[model samples]
Target chain A: MLEVKNLKKSFGDRVILDGVNLTVNDDEILCIVGPSGAGKTTLLRCITGLETPDSGTFLMNGQPFDPQGTKDSDRVIGVVFQDFNLFPNLSVMDNITLAPMMVLKETKKDAEKQAAQLLSELGLSTKGDLYPWQLSGGQKQRVAIARALAMKPKILCYDEPTSALDPNLRQEVAKIILNLKKSGMTQLVVTHDLDFAQEIADNLLKVKPID
Target chain B: MSLNYVFEILPSLFQGAWLTLQIFFWTLVVSIPLGIVVSLGLTSKIRPLQWILEVYVWLMRGTPLLLQLIFVFYGLPIIGIVFQRYDAALVAFILNYAAYFAEIFRGGFQSVSVGQFEAARVLRLSYWQTIRKIIIPQVVKIVIPSIGNEVINLVKDSSLVYVIGLGDLLRAGNVATSRDVTLVPLLLVALIYLILVGICTLVLRRVEKRYSYFK
Candidate 1:
């Protein structure tokens, strides 16, 4: 379970996320929706330790989560950016296996074995040798998910995942997230695409702007 | 002017080129990795360390190589730091080129996106792993052309070591010209530089092609 109590963040004199509180259970999809610049992404960043919050206590499985030091929480939480942010220089297989081999101390053969399985599940089996630049937006998004999944995180977080997709591809991303959820992966999606959000979210959190 | 005269100068020219090659080879062998270390210092989180590296880079860029060569060869002995002619020239060239290469590397490091670091952090990669696997390979691709330009410049700049009486290729040409009263040695030196730079351009182009997979 993940819980945030009175999470507050400010940039200079501008307040982004103002005294927000929320709780998320295991294997649940929680969607955060709000107007642009209302700090929805900031909240997600704060949770992932990408951005430091001014004040808040975050807990995952009853342990305090520290944003500055991801030592204990990196494996517990993963993020997929809207842009995908895949390593352009590496082949798909290399990208997916990197974290496992480096962080988990798995042998290359073992990591690749797991990666091959994950790629097949994500329908990227045949595309493993290709670089990220060669993939379509939808394909890149799927690879990003596979890359995150390779870490075996308890919760996967996404930032405006569908914002860059064509309207035709939005449904595909929604289905992918739903599939992960069905497979017992907890998720927190920050997106403006509410219809896509509604299709996957078991619960919703609204982030309101402060004057 | 005669083919026979050019042939007579060949041995001397080759000897000079050989010495020039030595300076070039030694400087490149040491400076590339040293530049990376200095670049890391420049980007380190410690403000004082960063400032120190910044000032070092600044001083190196601010002073002329000629003055540096002269100082290392001549002035250092006053401080009980005597050096051989060859070693003094090598030290000066490596320090100067290392500074240049460090600046070029800094540009390469900064060219990488912030997203790369964030992704690495989220993936639980150690800081060294992130740099070794993720950042450096990408930076190499981005800065190949910039580094290539500096290397070609190094070939031309290697001639400056003659100022310290190191007897490099240009110095050999000077001796041949003064002794033989022929312009052939100078023209030969020009051709050798062209060949060296041509070979480098080809290698650098192949590197750029290999990295084309990314962009």
Candidate 2:
């Protein structure tokens, strides 16, 4: 289980998130929907330890998540960015295995074995040798998902996953999120696409920007 | 131009060219990595150190390298800091080129977005791992053109060793021109410099192509 309380963030007098509270069960897909400038990304950033929250507690199984220290927060939460910021220089396989091999100190053979399994799971079994720029938008998204999954996080976060996709592609991503939820992967997704949100979310929360 | 005159001087000019190549090659070997180290410092969070690097870069960039060559080779001896002719020239060139390369690397670091860092963190990659596996690879691709330009400039700048009485390529050209009382040696020197720059350009372009698959 993941929980956040009284989450607040401000940048140079403009408050982005204010007194926000959230919780996600072990078997639920929690989607946060809001309009542009509504701090949806900021909320994800805060939880992922990218943006420091002004006052909040991000707890995973009752333990506070630390952005700067230890291996727990990273192991607990992994995020797929809106742009799918895979390492451009690495092949898809390397991107997926980088964290596993480097941070986890797994051997090359072991990381590659795990990455091959995840790639096949994401339907990218043939794309291991290809670079991120070679992949289509949907393929990149799947690779980003695989990259995140390779870390074995308890909660996976997606930031505006469908915002860049066409209507058809948005549905495709929605299916992926729903499939992950069915597999019992806890997910926190922030998106403006209400249709996608409604179709996949077990519980929906609204994040509003501060005035 | 008589063939005999050209051939007679070829051996001496070749020797001088060899010295020039050594200077260019060694300076690149020493300065490129040193510049990268300095670049890391420049981008680090320490304010006082960053300030010092800023002033150093400013001074190096603002002054003519020729003046720097003179200062290190000649001016430093006023306080008992004497150096051999080659040492003084090499030291000055290394410091000057490292400053320029540091700025190039600094720009490369700046070009990488915050999103990359966030993604690395999300993936649980440590800070050094992010830099080694993710950030530096992209920075190398982005900064190739700038580095190429600086490297070619370094090839030409090696000619400045003549001012310190190091018998480099341009110095050979001068001695031959004075002895033979002709401009042919100067033409040969220019031709060799052009060839060196051409080779560097080709190599850099090839490296850039190798990394092009990223974007």
Candidate 3:
């Protein structure tokens, strides 16, 4: 289980996340839904260590979690950015294998083997040698998910996973999220698509901007 | 225009070209890395260091390379910072080119988006790993044409060493021309410079091709 207590964040004088709290059970999907300017993405960013909360505490399995300690939090949390932030200079195979080899000290063969597995699982088996620019929107998103999964994070976060997809692709993403849940992956998704959230979220947290 | 005259001046011109090549090679060896470091400092968060480097770049870029060489060779002696003619030309050339390269690298660094850094952070990549694997490849792609421009300029700018009485290629040509009362040596010198720059262009094109794997 992961718990966030009394999270608060402000940029200059504008408060984004004000004293927010949430919880996610193991092997569950948690969706954060809010309109524009409601700080749903900000909350996810704070949880993923992309932004520092003014004051907050994160607990993983009842132990305190420190997102600022990169080494400790890196393996514990992963993010699939809105734009899919794949390394443009790298092919899909290399993008997925880079962190495993560089940070996890896995051999190139081992990392490539695991990346091939993930690509096959994500229906990207033949796309490994292709660059991100060549992939369609849905394919890129799946590659981003595969890239994050390669790290084997305890929890994965997504920022607007369905924002760029069409209706059919949105359903495709929902199915992928459901499949991840079946494999016992914890997830936090922030999006304004309430219907999509309701379709995949085991629980939903709604946020409103603090004036 | 005679082959005999060309051969007669060839040895002396070759000697001067050797010195010119030495200055060019050493200046690039030292200045390229120095420029990368200075560019990192420019983008760093330290305010005073950024200001200092900004002023340094401004000073170096604002002045002519010839004037800088003259200042290092002739003007610094009054302040007790005397250097040999060859050393003075090298010091001035390195400092001046480093400034231009710094600006070029700074632009390359800025072109990278903030998300690239954030992605590296979440992936547990150390600072150096991020720079080596992710950042550098992208920056190199973006900055190669700019770097090629500077490199070609450095080849031509090496002639500025002649102002310090160093017998560089242009100076040797000038000597032969004045002594023989003929323009042939100067023409040969121009041909030599064209050949050097042509080689650089071919090599740079190959480098650019290697990085063409991505857009």
Model 1 Cα lDDT, one tens digit per residue, A113-197: 9899989988889999999989999999889999998888878999999888888988888888888888889999998767777
How well is each residue in B134-201 modelled by candidate 1, as lDDT tens digits?
A: 99999998778888988888888999888888888888888988887878899998888888889889
The prediction achieving the highest lDDT against the true structure is: 3
Cα displacement (angstroms), candidate 1, residue B25, comes to 1.3
Residue-wise C-alpha lDDT for candidate 3, range B1-215, written one tens digit per residue: 89999999999999999999999999999998899899989999999999999999999999998999999999999899999999999999999999998999899989998888888888888888988898889999999999999999999999999888999999999999999999999999999999999999999999999999886
Docking model 2 quality class? high
| Candidates' C-alpha lDDT | 0.88, 0.88, 0.92
Model 2 residue A184 distance off true place after TM-score fit, in angstroms = 1.6
Q: What TM-score would every model get versus the actual structure?
A: 0.96, 0.95, 0.97
Lowest lDDT 10-residue stretch of candidate 1 chain B: B163-172
The segments of candidate 3 whose C-alpha lies over 4 angstroms from its true place after superposition are none
In model 2, the runs with Cα more than 4 Å from the true position are none
- Pick out the ten consecutive residues of candidate 2 chain B with the lowest summed lDDT: B121-130
| Chain B TM-score (model 1 vs. true structure) | 0.97
Q: How high is the DockQ of candidate 3?
A: 0.77
Model 3 chain A weakest lDDT span, ten residues long: A66-75
Segments of candidate 1 deviating more than 4 angstroms: A67-74
DockQ of every model listed? 0.76, 0.80, 0.77
- How big an interface RMSD has model 2? 1.1
True contacts kept of each: 0.77, 0.89, 0.70
